[model samples]
Target: MARKHLVTHPSTAMMIRDTKAAEVAVLEHHERLDGSGYPRGLASADITPMGPILLLAEAFAYWDQLKVTLSPGTAKALADSAFAFADSCLLALQKALIDASPHTTPAPG
Candidate 1:
Protein backbone atom coordinates (compact mmCIF):
# COMPACT_ATOMS: atom_id res chain seq x y z
CA MET A 1 0.00 0.00 0.00
CA ALA A 2 0.99 3.65 -0.43
CA ARG A 3 1.28 4.04 3.34
CA LYS A 4 3.79 1.25 3.66
CA HIS A 5 5.72 2.52 0.62
CA LEU A 6 5.78 6.18 1.64
CA VAL A 7 7.13 5.63 5.15
CA THR A 8 10.91 6.10 4.94
CA HIS A 9 11.86 6.13 8.62
CA PRO A 10 13.70 2.92 9.35
CA SER A 11 12.92 3.12 13.03
CA THR A 12 9.27 3.86 12.41
CA ALA A 13 9.01 1.04 9.87
CA MET A 14 10.59 -1.34 12.29
CA MET A 15 8.20 -0.20 14.99
CA ILE A 16 5.34 -0.78 12.60
CA ARG A 17 6.36 -4.38 11.98
CA ASP A 18 8.21 -5.58 15.04
CA THR A 19 6.39 -4.05 17.99
CA LYS A 20 3.29 -2.68 16.23
CA ALA A 21 2.58 -0.55 19.29
CA ALA A 22 2.73 2.81 17.54
CA GLU A 23 1.15 1.51 14.37
CA VAL A 24 -1.76 -0.07 16.20
CA ALA A 25 -2.25 3.06 18.27
CA VAL A 26 -2.27 5.53 15.40
CA LEU A 27 -3.63 3.36 12.60
CA GLU A 28 -6.30 1.90 14.81
CA HIS A 29 -7.22 5.08 16.64
CA HIS A 30 -10.80 4.85 15.46
CA GLU A 31 -11.21 1.42 16.97
CA ARG A 32 -13.28 1.04 20.11
CA LEU A 33 -12.20 -1.08 23.07
CA ASP A 34 -15.15 -3.38 22.39
CA GLY A 35 -13.91 -5.03 19.20
CA SER A 36 -15.73 -2.50 17.02
CA GLY A 37 -12.99 -1.15 14.79
CA TYR A 38 -11.85 -1.23 11.20
CA PRO A 39 -8.74 -2.73 9.53
CA ARG A 40 -8.85 -5.16 12.42
CA GLY A 41 -11.44 -5.92 15.09
CA LEU A 42 -9.20 -5.68 18.13
CA ALA A 43 -10.69 -5.42 21.61
CA SER A 44 -9.60 -4.33 25.07
CA ALA A 45 -6.25 -5.69 26.30
CA ASP A 46 -5.42 -6.13 22.62
CA ILE A 47 -5.21 -2.33 22.40
CA THR A 48 -2.02 -0.80 23.74
CA PRO A 49 -1.81 2.06 26.23
CA MET A 50 -0.83 4.55 23.55
CA GLY A 51 -3.85 3.73 21.43
CA PRO A 52 -6.35 5.30 23.82
CA ILE A 53 -4.23 8.37 24.32
CA LEU A 54 -3.75 8.87 20.61
CA LEU A 55 -7.42 8.37 19.91
CA LEU A 56 -8.50 10.86 22.58
CA ALA A 57 -5.91 13.36 21.38
CA GLU A 58 -7.25 13.06 17.86
CA ALA A 59 -10.80 13.66 19.08
CA PHE A 60 -9.74 16.67 21.10
CA ALA A 61 -7.85 18.14 18.15
CA TYR A 62 -10.74 17.65 15.77
CA TRP A 63 -13.16 19.25 18.22
CA ASP A 64 -10.80 22.16 18.77
CA GLN A 65 -10.40 22.68 15.06
CA LEU A 66 -14.15 22.83 14.69
CA LYS A 67 -14.49 25.35 17.54
CA VAL A 68 -16.72 22.89 19.38
CA THR A 69 -15.95 23.15 23.04
CA LEU A 70 -17.01 20.33 25.29
CA SER A 71 -17.45 20.93 28.99
CA PRO A 72 -15.16 18.99 31.28
CA GLY A 73 -18.12 17.00 32.53
CA THR A 74 -19.20 16.07 29.00
CA ALA A 75 -15.69 15.15 27.96
CA LYS A 76 -15.21 13.12 31.10
CA ALA A 77 -18.48 11.28 30.55
CA LEU A 78 -17.56 10.41 27.00
CA ALA A 79 -14.12 9.20 28.02
CA ASP A 80 -15.51 7.25 30.94
CA SER A 81 -17.94 5.41 28.74
CA ALA A 82 -16.56 1.89 28.87
CA PHE A 83 -18.82 0.95 25.97
CA ALA A 84 -17.08 3.40 23.67
CA PHE A 85 -13.53 4.15 24.86
CA ALA A 86 -10.64 3.39 27.21
CA ASP A 87 -11.07 4.93 30.67
CA SER A 88 -7.46 4.83 31.87
CA CYS A 89 -6.04 7.11 29.18
CA LEU A 90 -8.94 9.54 29.47
CA LEU A 91 -8.49 9.77 33.22
CA ALA A 92 -4.79 10.40 32.73
CA LEU A 93 -5.49 13.17 30.23
CA GLN A 94 -8.00 14.75 32.61
CA LYS A 95 -5.48 14.62 35.42
CA ALA A 96 -2.84 16.22 33.23
CA LEU A 97 -5.20 19.03 32.34
CA ILE A 98 -6.03 19.61 35.98
CA ASP A 99 -2.38 19.65 36.92
CA ALA A 100 -1.48 22.06 34.13
CA SER A 101 -4.18 24.61 34.86
CA PRO A 102 -3.28 26.95 37.70
CA HIS A 103 -6.54 28.92 37.88
CA THR A 104 -9.08 26.36 36.72
CA THR A 105 -10.50 24.18 39.44
CA PRO A 106 -10.27 20.43 38.98
CA ALA A 107 -13.55 18.96 37.78
CA PRO A 108 -15.20 16.33 39.92
CA GLY A 109 -14.84 12.82 38.52
Candidate 2:
Protein backbone atom coordinates (compact mmCIF):
# COMPACT_ATOMS: atom_id res chain seq x y z
CA MET A 1 0.00 0.00 0.00
CA ALA A 2 3.04 2.24 0.10
CA ARG A 3 2.48 2.87 -3.53
CA LYS A 4 -0.93 4.28 -2.65
CA HIS A 5 0.53 6.75 -0.25
CA LEU A 6 3.21 7.62 -2.74
CA VAL A 7 0.55 8.72 -5.16
CA THR A 8 -0.90 11.18 -2.66
CA HIS A 9 2.28 12.62 -1.31
CA PRO A 10 2.61 16.40 -1.42
CA SER A 11 4.83 16.10 -4.48
CA THR A 12 2.54 13.62 -6.17
CA ALA A 13 -0.83 15.02 -5.19
CA MET A 14 0.36 18.33 -6.63
CA MET A 15 0.83 16.61 -9.96
CA ILE A 16 -2.87 15.83 -9.89
CA ARG A 17 -3.56 19.50 -9.11
CA ASP A 18 -4.60 18.47 -5.59
CA THR A 19 -8.07 17.72 -6.85
CA LYS A 20 -10.11 15.86 -4.27
CA ALA A 21 -12.04 14.03 -6.94
CA ALA A 22 -8.88 12.67 -8.54
CA GLU A 23 -7.32 11.80 -5.22
CA VAL A 24 -10.36 9.95 -3.94
CA ALA A 25 -10.76 8.13 -7.24
CA VAL A 26 -7.20 6.90 -7.08
CA LEU A 27 -7.47 5.81 -3.45
CA GLU A 28 -10.87 4.17 -3.70
CA HIS A 29 -9.97 2.21 -6.81
CA HIS A 30 -7.84 -0.15 -4.72
CA GLU A 31 -10.01 -0.21 -1.60
CA ARG A 32 -12.25 -3.19 -0.90
CA LEU A 33 -15.03 -3.90 1.57
CA ASP A 34 -13.22 -7.05 2.71
CA GLY A 35 -10.26 -4.93 3.86
CA SER A 36 -7.99 -7.01 1.64
CA GLY A 37 -7.28 -4.18 -0.77
CA TYR A 38 -4.22 -1.98 -0.58
CA PRO A 39 -3.26 1.53 0.60
CA ARG A 40 -5.69 2.14 3.45
CA GLY A 41 -7.32 -1.27 3.80
CA LEU A 42 -10.65 0.53 3.96
CA ALA A 43 -13.85 -1.51 4.06
CA SER A 44 -17.51 -1.04 3.14
CA ALA A 45 -18.71 2.51 3.80
CA ASP A 46 -15.18 3.83 3.71
CA ILE A 47 -14.93 3.25 -0.02
CA THR A 48 -16.11 5.94 -2.41
CA PRO A 49 -18.88 5.39 -4.97
CA MET A 50 -16.43 5.61 -7.86
CA GLY A 51 -14.18 3.05 -6.19
CA PRO A 52 -16.31 0.02 -7.01
CA ILE A 53 -17.01 1.21 -10.51
CA LEU A 54 -13.33 1.57 -11.29
CA LEU A 55 -12.55 -1.78 -9.68
CA LEU A 56 -15.22 -3.54 -11.67
CA ALA A 57 -14.13 -1.95 -14.92
CA GLU A 58 -10.51 -2.82 -14.39
CA ALA A 59 -11.30 -6.36 -13.28
CA PHE A 60 -13.53 -6.99 -16.25
CA ALA A 61 -10.95 -5.69 -18.66
CA TYR A 62 -8.13 -7.62 -17.05
CA TRP A 63 -10.14 -10.84 -16.97
CA ASP A 64 -11.02 -10.48 -20.62
CA GLN A 65 -7.40 -9.90 -21.57
CA LEU A 66 -6.17 -12.85 -19.52
CA LYS A 67 -8.89 -15.21 -20.76
CA VAL A 68 -8.84 -13.94 -24.36
CA THR A 69 -12.55 -13.20 -24.19
CA LEU A 70 -14.93 -10.77 -22.52
CA SER A 71 -17.23 -13.07 -20.61
CA PRO A 72 -20.34 -11.55 -19.14
CA GLY A 73 -20.49 -14.46 -16.73
CA THR A 74 -17.12 -13.46 -15.35
CA ALA A 75 -18.34 -9.90 -14.83
CA LYS A 76 -21.37 -11.18 -12.98
CA ALA A 77 -19.22 -13.50 -10.89
CA LEU A 78 -16.95 -10.66 -9.83
CA ALA A 79 -19.84 -8.34 -9.10
CA ASP A 80 -21.61 -11.01 -7.08
CA SER A 81 -18.58 -11.51 -4.90
CA ALA A 82 -18.08 -10.01 -1.39
CA PHE A 83 -16.16 -7.04 -2.79
CA ALA A 84 -19.06 -4.70 -1.92
CA PHE A 85 -19.42 -3.24 -5.43
CA ALA A 86 -22.27 -0.92 -6.24
CA ASP A 87 -25.28 -2.82 -7.50
CA SER A 88 -26.18 -0.11 -9.98
CA CYS A 89 -22.76 -0.31 -11.62
CA LEU A 90 -23.05 -4.08 -11.93
CA LEU A 91 -26.51 -3.76 -13.38
CA ALA A 92 -25.31 -1.15 -15.84
CA LEU A 93 -22.47 -3.38 -17.00
CA GLN A 94 -24.84 -6.30 -17.38
CA LYS A 95 -27.26 -4.23 -19.40
CA ALA A 96 -24.43 -2.94 -21.57
CA LEU A 97 -23.20 -6.43 -22.37
CA ILE A 98 -26.71 -7.68 -23.04
CA ASP A 99 -27.35 -4.78 -25.35
CA ALA A 100 -24.16 -5.47 -27.24
CA SER A 101 -24.82 -9.17 -27.70
CA PRO A 102 -26.36 -10.18 -30.97
CA HIS A 103 -28.23 -13.17 -29.60
CA THR A 104 -29.38 -11.88 -26.23
CA THR A 105 -32.20 -9.42 -25.99
CA PRO A 106 -31.23 -6.55 -23.74
CA ALA A 107 -33.33 -6.60 -20.61
CA PRO A 108 -35.05 -3.41 -19.56
CA GLY A 109 -33.20 -1.43 -16.96
Candidate 3:
Protein backbone atom coordinates (compact mmCIF):
# COMPACT_ATOMS: atom_id res chain seq x y z
CA MET A 1 0.00 0.00 0.00
CA ALA A 2 1.17 3.50 -0.79
CA ARG A 3 2.03 6.01 1.97
CA LYS A 4 -0.89 8.23 0.97
CA HIS A 5 -3.21 5.35 1.71
CA LEU A 6 -2.37 5.74 5.39
CA VAL A 7 -4.00 9.16 5.34
CA THR A 8 -7.01 8.23 3.21
CA HIS A 9 -7.61 4.63 4.28
CA PRO A 10 -11.19 4.07 5.43
CA SER A 11 -10.07 2.44 8.65
CA THR A 12 -7.90 5.43 9.46
CA ALA A 13 -10.88 7.71 9.04
CA MET A 14 -12.45 6.14 12.09
CA MET A 15 -9.25 5.76 14.09
CA ILE A 16 -7.93 9.27 13.54
CA ARG A 17 -9.88 12.13 14.98
CA ASP A 18 -10.49 15.30 13.04
CA THR A 19 -7.65 17.63 14.03
CA LYS A 20 -5.26 19.80 12.05
CA ALA A 21 -2.18 18.49 13.82
CA ALA A 22 -3.30 14.89 13.35
CA GLU A 23 -4.03 15.50 9.68
CA VAL A 24 -0.70 17.21 9.09
CA ALA A 25 1.22 14.47 10.85
CA VAL A 26 -0.55 11.74 8.90
CA LEU A 27 -0.33 13.52 5.57
CA GLU A 28 3.28 14.53 6.00
CA HIS A 29 4.44 11.29 7.54
CA HIS A 30 5.98 10.06 4.29
CA GLU A 31 7.59 13.41 3.50
CA ARG A 32 11.38 13.55 3.69
CA LEU A 33 13.67 16.22 5.09
CA ASP A 34 15.39 16.38 1.68
CA GLY A 35 12.10 16.88 -0.22
CA SER A 36 12.46 13.46 -1.88
CA GLY A 37 9.29 11.93 -0.47
CA TYR A 38 5.91 11.44 -2.14
CA PRO A 39 2.49 13.16 -2.14
CA ARG A 40 4.26 16.43 -1.39
CA GLY A 41 7.95 17.25 -1.54
CA LEU A 42 8.49 19.06 1.75
CA ALA A 43 12.08 19.77 2.72
CA SER A 44 13.75 20.73 5.99
CA ALA A 45 11.67 23.30 7.87
CA ASP A 46 8.79 22.76 5.49
CA ILE A 47 8.05 19.44 7.11
CA THR A 48 6.06 19.50 10.35
CA PRO A 49 7.75 18.46 13.59
CA MET A 50 5.42 15.48 13.98
CA GLY A 51 6.21 14.37 10.45
CA PRO A 52 9.78 13.34 11.28
CA ILE A 53 8.68 11.72 14.52
CA LEU A 54 6.13 9.62 12.67
CA LEU A 55 8.65 8.82 9.98
CA LEU A 56 11.19 7.68 12.56
CA ALA A 57 8.59 5.59 14.36
CA GLU A 58 7.41 4.09 11.09
CA ALA A 59 10.96 3.18 10.10
CA PHE A 60 11.58 1.44 13.39
CA ALA A 61 8.24 -0.31 13.23
CA TYR A 62 8.96 -1.52 9.72
CA TRP A 63 12.27 -2.97 10.85
CA ASP A 64 10.71 -4.48 13.94
CA GLN A 65 7.99 -6.11 11.85
CA LEU A 66 10.74 -7.72 9.82
CA LYS A 67 12.26 -9.08 13.06
CA VAL A 68 15.42 -7.04 12.66
CA THR A 69 17.35 -6.74 15.88
CA LEU A 70 18.44 -3.12 15.76
CA SER A 71 21.40 -2.21 17.88
CA PRO A 72 22.02 1.52 18.46
CA GLY A 73 24.46 1.60 15.56
CA THR A 74 22.09 -0.27 13.28
CA ALA A 75 19.22 1.99 14.28
CA LYS A 76 21.32 5.09 13.63
CA ALA A 77 22.34 3.74 10.23
CA LEU A 78 18.74 3.00 9.38
CA ALA A 79 17.63 6.48 10.44
CA ASP A 80 20.43 8.05 8.41
CA SER A 81 19.29 6.12 5.36
CA ALA A 82 15.62 6.95 5.94
CA PHE A 83 15.92 10.61 6.92
CA ALA A 84 18.07 13.37 5.49
CA PHE A 85 18.13 15.15 8.86
CA ALA A 86 18.44 11.98 10.90
CA ASP A 87 21.16 13.32 13.15
CA SER A 88 19.10 16.31 14.26
CA CYS A 89 15.97 14.26 14.73
CA LEU A 90 17.81 11.52 16.61
CA LEU A 91 19.44 14.08 18.88
CA ALA A 92 16.08 15.68 19.58
CA LEU A 93 14.53 12.29 20.29
CA GLN A 94 17.39 11.38 22.61
CA LYS A 95 16.98 14.66 24.49
CA ALA A 96 13.25 14.12 24.75
CA LEU A 97 13.82 10.62 26.13
CA ILE A 98 16.42 11.82 28.59
CA ASP A 99 14.17 14.62 29.78
CA ALA A 100 11.30 12.23 30.25
CA SER A 101 13.32 9.66 32.20
CA PRO A 102 12.72 9.88 35.94
CA HIS A 103 16.14 8.47 36.67
CA THR A 104 17.97 10.94 34.45
CA THR A 105 20.03 13.66 36.04
CA PRO A 106 20.61 16.95 34.22
CA ALA A 107 24.02 17.02 32.62
CA PRO A 108 26.46 19.64 33.93
CA GLY A 109 26.59 22.43 31.40
Which candidate's TM-score is highest? Answer: 3
Tens-digit lDDT string for candidate 2 (1-109): 5464546543454577646865676667877778777778888778877677767777667644454343567556766776656667767666655554444466999
- Report the poorest 10 consecutive residues by lDDT, candidate 1: 2-11
TM-score, candidate number 2: 0.58
Q: Give the poorly placed runs of model 1, Cα more than 4 Å off.
A: 1-20, 80-83, 92-109
**Residue lDDT tens for model 3, 1-109:** 5654865743464566666677777777788877888678888778888877877677655654554544557447756764664676666554544444454478999
TM-score for each model: 0.54, 0.58, 0.62
Per-model lDDT: 0.61, 0.65, 0.66
After TM-score superposition, the amount by which residue 84's alpha carbon in candidate 2 deviates from its true location, in angstroms, is 3.8
Off by over 4 Å in 3: 4-18, 91-109
Q: Score residue 57 of candidate 1 by CA lDDT.
A: 82
Arrange candidates by lDDT, descending.
3, 2, 1
**Model 1, global lDDT:** 0.61
In model 3, residue pairs whose N, Cα or C atoms come closer than 3 Å (at least 3 residues apart or on different chains), thus clashing, are none
Model with the higher lDDT, candidate 1 or 2: 2
lDDT of 1 by residue, 32-99 (tens): 78877644767877777676677778766665555554557865678656436666665655565555
